[model samples]
Target chain A: MTLYSFIFYILAAVILLSTGWAITRRNLVHAVIYLVISFFGSAMLFYLMGAPLLAALEVIIYAGAIMILFLFIIMMLRVEGIEERLFPLKQWLPAMGLGFISFQVCIFLLISAGSEEPLKAAMAEPAIFGHFLFRQHWLSIEIVSMLLLIALIGVLHLGMEKKRKESGE
Target chain B: MIVPYSHVIFLAGILFLMGMFCTVTRRNLMMMVLGLEIMLNAAAIAFIGAALRHGHMDGHAMVIFIIAVAAAEVSIGLALIVCIYRKTGTIDAGCIEGDVCEL
Candidate 1:
């Protein structure tokens, strides 16, 4: 394997390992920290895959913004002392069985398709990517912006403290 | 050429399965949302890999949108989770009536 593939394998291993740790941690803060590492690994993978713009955005939005949001909520809730059944046999066994069966099916289909071609490395420069995105998907961008606005409004409404006095008035 | 496209697909599938497992087995509402984020990240990786394989920008575009949607989803989902915690005094999915939350 060449240097790029070697780096890819290492990064993939890091991501999988960190994500596995993330899910198993009982402390939500610990899970979020592990997930941040996983996201960093994924951002590097995006860079290796020649999506530099996505790499940066992944770091900025996912590892930085989203994770911080999760951290804030976890801190605000202070539910760390709430003991969780990490792996109740009833739920764990069924989930594992279903996951294993689905994964087997996925592998079977993948092998049946039998495409062994290697991926050719190509880069999408930020400039060209932006131009193409705006040119073809400006409407999509607009729709997403609207979606964000709606989400913002919904969050504000949900987080608003109800006026108990108003009910009596 | 770096690696076979199948390797990327395999990686994504494994990540997706792990995310599914997390979502299914974890009783915490936050963990479920975290699992969803993991699944979305796996899908983003797959899309980037496909973009590289097919020599197109479409997959990258999709990932951009995926990230945006994830941001929106997380904000709203967490807000709802906070509201639930406020009403029920616990974030545990199993403790619906607040009896189990002794603290």
Candidate 2:
């Protein structure tokens, strides 16, 4: 196999296995860690796709920011480190079976469809990406900013009032 | 091309289904959120693969938007999870009782 195909296969395997492991873990923190690995793998795969800007954003935003958010929430909830929660065979087995079966089905479907050959890869440089993002997608950017602001306000509204009462007692 | 476009799509499908399995089987609220994040990652992979396949900047643009949406989602979701823990004293979705959390 070509080096490119080899790298692609390895990254894809890394993502799949890490996510599977993450889901199977009983400890929430452990799961989050695995999720981070999976996200990092996904970011690398994004790099392989030639969208370097998107890949960097995936690493920064998803692997870095999002995971830190998860860890903070877990810490605040005081469920850090190991957990005593059990994943019984009843639940774990069924989920594993479902995941495996779906994986098989997807492979089968992909092979059956007989894919067209992929085109020559193009590098999507950040300079061009930035211009297109701001120029053609300005409206989406504005809307997303508005969404983030509303979410921030909602979170503050949800959190501050409750804390005030709890501390007052 | 390094790998066939269809193979990338297949990989995305596996990740999405694995996420689905996690969401369906897990009783913990945080696990469900993690599952959702995995599902979003799968979507991003597919988008990036499509961009590579077509040599179009539009797919890259879409992936960027997806990242923005995912960030917003995770922020709001984690906030909600923290709120739930504050009010209910637990994050177990299955154990929620008496209007504390609805399934």
DockQ of 2: 0.58
Q: How close is candidate 1 to the true structure, as a TM-score?
A: 0.92
The residue pairs in collision within model 2 are: none
lDDT of 1 by residue, B16-101 (tens): 98898799778899999999999999999999999999899999999999999999999999998998887788888878665665
The ten-residue window of minimal lDDT in model 1 chain A covers: A160-169
Q: Write the per-residue lDDT of candidate 2 for residues B6-37, one digit (tens) a residue.
A: 89889998888888778876778888888888
Off by over 4 Å in 1: A86-94, A109-115, A161-169, B97-103
True contacts kept of each: 0.76, 0.67
User: How does model 2 score by TM-score?
Assistant: 0.88
Candidate 1 per-residue C-alpha lDDT over A1-169 given as tens digits, one digit per residue, 9 for 90 to 100? 7888999999999999999999999999999999999999999999999999999999999999999999999989968766666665567677778878988977875686566766777889999999999999999999999999999999988877544434656
Pairs in steric clash, model 1: none
The 10 consecutive residues of candidate 2 chain B with the worst lDDT sum are: B94-103
